[model samples]
Target: MSTRTDTTSQAGARAPGQREPTAPGFERLDAEYVLPLRWSEYRTGDVLELTDYLVRIAPNLDVTVVDGSPDDIFAAHHQLWADLVRHVKPDGEATANGKVAGVMTGIRLARHRAVILADDDVRYDRPSLERMVAELHDADLVRPQNYFTELPWHARWDTARSLINRAVASDYPGTMGINRDLVLELGGYDGDVLFENLELMRTIQAAHGRERRVDDLFVGRVPPRAAHFGRQRVRQAYDDFAQPARLVLELSLLPLLAWSIRRPLRLAGVAALAAALAEVGRRRAGGSRVFPATSALWAPAWLLERAVCVWVAVGSRMLGGAKYGDARLKTAAHSVPALRRKLTRADGRPGRGRRSTTSRPR
Candidate 1:
């Protein structure tokens, strides 16, 4: 484990003290694969992935950035991560990237004993790696939680999905304290990168026969207010009614309530009513009462976004294409299979984009 030290300078620089990184202890295995992102440009609503990367890992550690200013539209750099990992030398100890890139970076860089895969939007109070190092003592994996500054509606959706994933979706051994090596042993993230973090956690549990653990420092913050509200409509549209079950079980009644009106009007009325109720429920559930009017206006847009996502999801799968973010989705697109195979290879095979695997930690 690393040791922490607190140091304050006369110039008003306060470096929170932490255990000195056991870089020396792990010196024999000191190297790590690092990825940092600075995007070229993206639409206002599309930069969360990049923002998430900057906020999460930049303060605590150095990163490896791609040379040019990359655009932020997800597809532009979707496979860029896979290309970057192949450039990492085997002597490197670990690797990490943000959003899709970070996961791929870590998997490709896993030649040594330790690898850290993290969400880049989170901020650690101190140098982040120490927690992973200490937990690495007997644990196979370590992951952190998403700590939000002000919970946005989109963040709430993510929270719901994450909670469901952790609390009830599935079970695996040693899942409480997730680790990189354990993830490798489980055949890597299998492409659908959306839930790789959970996948890694599950993989660790399966390999080490224990649950993954959480640390005190793993915290995340919400996006900036401008970004939050500006993009809120799009995210809500994409998320809120995307699932049939959520629509049928949770929101279906709204349209029925407003049915006599025109279709758009009915949907609008239902959306407004539902948003109000959800706000009330949120307050009742011990959340803040600070609801924004923009949130109400955006609710209907999410209905449209949800419809599009559902259509896309269904179409993609039906046409032998997996959902956009899953590994199998890549399989349907010929370019991804070769890259995926390269990104997930073990045994030092020089395959581009193949990932390396780790043994089960005893």
Candidate 2:
């Protein structure tokens, strides 16, 4: 792989893996990849810890921070990260989902074809980082599993969600590795969706691109604060709208429980079934290594929470849409058929081609 200069900042003059003053005592690794860490914040609480992680990984990857913070906070972030990484404000007009704008800007500013996109709370060590980049060699998009580093009570409660997802299907994670050229070719995914990660994955698949879900490749994520976790309950349940089957099942959960109320044994059996499914998931894809054995016990509780929250999400939808950033977003994600139609229209345009000609090893 070859390195390219980052036109977004003067720091691009330095070669890939070049050490900056802030990143002392760490030698640059021989990996050829770029990491686009995209985030938007009105506050600066996580800046210090995130900066430390960036400094350590700066020597291994060409890092770019696409910040969507207010001017003052953005300036503060630039002052801290300007030397160790390319720091830039998110370009282009804002969208309903601000994170997608930052992600698009970071991809546009990325210096390499192999790009790793991550949220602020994601932390990748050298080994996992390298493996993600390597996997992108044969895939258009790579989805890795995420495990929280420090498991608080809330984190363990959320772990049950991941366990159930692992049992049924791949869990959607905070980070993904992508081939920049392919995403660009697809003209990027919709920025108006609530579940942006799922939107991106479906967009890739709709374009007939290869998407590799690496269940065994675990990445570390910083758990959200308890209060933040509390706020996300209904919003997280609303994401199920993206998958109709899941949405229907969750919507029916309360009614099912109510019907089973007359028979206590049936309610107990339902909870046991949920726990058993979570346990099966916990035991899949080496989940036992990163997920606690006790996480399965929380599955029934998580399901109950979702049973109520899904109704709240429905009410929010009926009122208008879910509140995201400064706007309300009605769609969770575009259906695959809808995305395919959009891709077809793009391909039919005079200057666009049906697919990108970029070569990838099979």
Candidate 3:
């Protein structure tokens, strides 16, 4: 039960806490949650939760981490990715894929039959991974849905924001597994896109491949810090650039609300109905209970914030900004490099001046 042992095997077999590597020949039939890991000083409870999940799901691989550092005993799987230049808020433009770019790039190069990308933010059980892999049997790409867990007061304020997102946008799960070859054919994900997963799926569909959302099985992500969550209203609004359909839906909400304001009863009815739909979505987005009915109080705030943020995003685009996140909000018209090439093929890990190391935060 404790994964705190100091010793580990020389051959890079998994330890109690470390995740098992992808099976040889890249022929794994089951889907696993792939975490492209960076080092962490995890709390005991967090570590224990992660440990239990890994141990209980051994071989089944509820989760897998792509380690950049060589400290872990199970470091061989770290070799799966070529060192690219990874960085947390890199200097040039933080346009690169957030966490899993390296893993996705590695899969592209290894020509792996399949790989799944999962970030450390989410809270989920092992069965969710099984559902995703099962979905992949018939589709080229599969994404799960996510809801916020741990409704810190700030998260409750943003609850409606997330709900509106679920209603209008195609849910880009906190994790996804896809065929490497398909990614290669689509030229990989557009690294600079604010919504890389959506961009990835859009490219896949453009190529005439099958893609689907496994909605019944859900996952959860850490609630954003209050400050970050506020900025996220605008930042993610900018991300909708990739999902035009959602973008249009979001845009329509403003005018609908404006009209509803002229009729208080009608406005209240619509708001209440939408909030109920949001709660329904939350229920379906499988995860432990956390949302408060009172959280729905923030739905109006979510609507107003999205409306204003969409304008901010559009204004930045008009000003020629490239991508958005971390509130950099800079404007640059130059194009970024291919997502695959960003992860350079050197030393099985990154070489200096190529890319920086990954930083683990929400």
- Which candidate comes out best when scored by TM-score? 2
- Candidates sorted on TM-score, descending: 2, 3, 1
lDDT by residue (tens digit), candidate 1, 1-362: 11112211111122222233233334222323344333445443334343333333333443333322333333443433322232222222222212434454545554544554443333443444555555555556544444354566664443333332233222111112334454544545433432334444433433333443442333444444556444433323223222345435434433454463567776666667645544442333112322232333444444444444544544444565433322333131112234334434543433222243332212
Model 2 deviation from native, Cα RMSD in Å: 6.8
Structural similarity to truth (TM-score) of each candidate? 0.43, 0.86, 0.64
Predicted candidate 3 versus true structure: per-residue lDDT over 1-362, tens digit per residue:
22423222321233244444334453434544456544333344443444444443444443345443334423322222112111121122223444435455345434234556766566555456556666666667776666676778777766666555555444556677676666665455555545555566654554445666665456767775578676666667877665567679888877888888999997898778777767664554442254556665677666677877887788877776534434343321112222223323322222122232211111
Name every residue pair that clashes in candidate 3.
Answer: 83-349, 83-350, 85-355, 86-356
For candidate 3, what is the TM-score? Answer: 0.64
Off by over 4 Å in 2: 1-45, 349-362
Return the lDDT, model 2, position 123: 83
Summing lDDT over every window of 10 consecutive residues in candidate 1, give the lowest-scoring window.
Answer: 2-11
Local accuracy of candidate 2 as per-residue lDDT tens digits, 1-362:
12223322323333243234334554544333333443445343365566657766776778888877777667666766776778887788777888888888888777778888888889888778878877887777888999999999999999999999989987889999887887887777888899998998888777777777888889999999999899889889989888999999999999999999899999999999999999998888788999888989999899899999999999989977888756788999988778888888877632233342332222
| lDDT of every model, 2 decimals | 0.38, 0.78, 0.53
**lDDT assessment of candidate 1:** 0.38
Task: Give every collision pair in model 2.
Answer: none
Model 1 ranges with Cα > 4 A deviation: 1-112, 127-129, 150-178, 183-187, 192-194, 205-209, 213-218, 222-312, 319-362
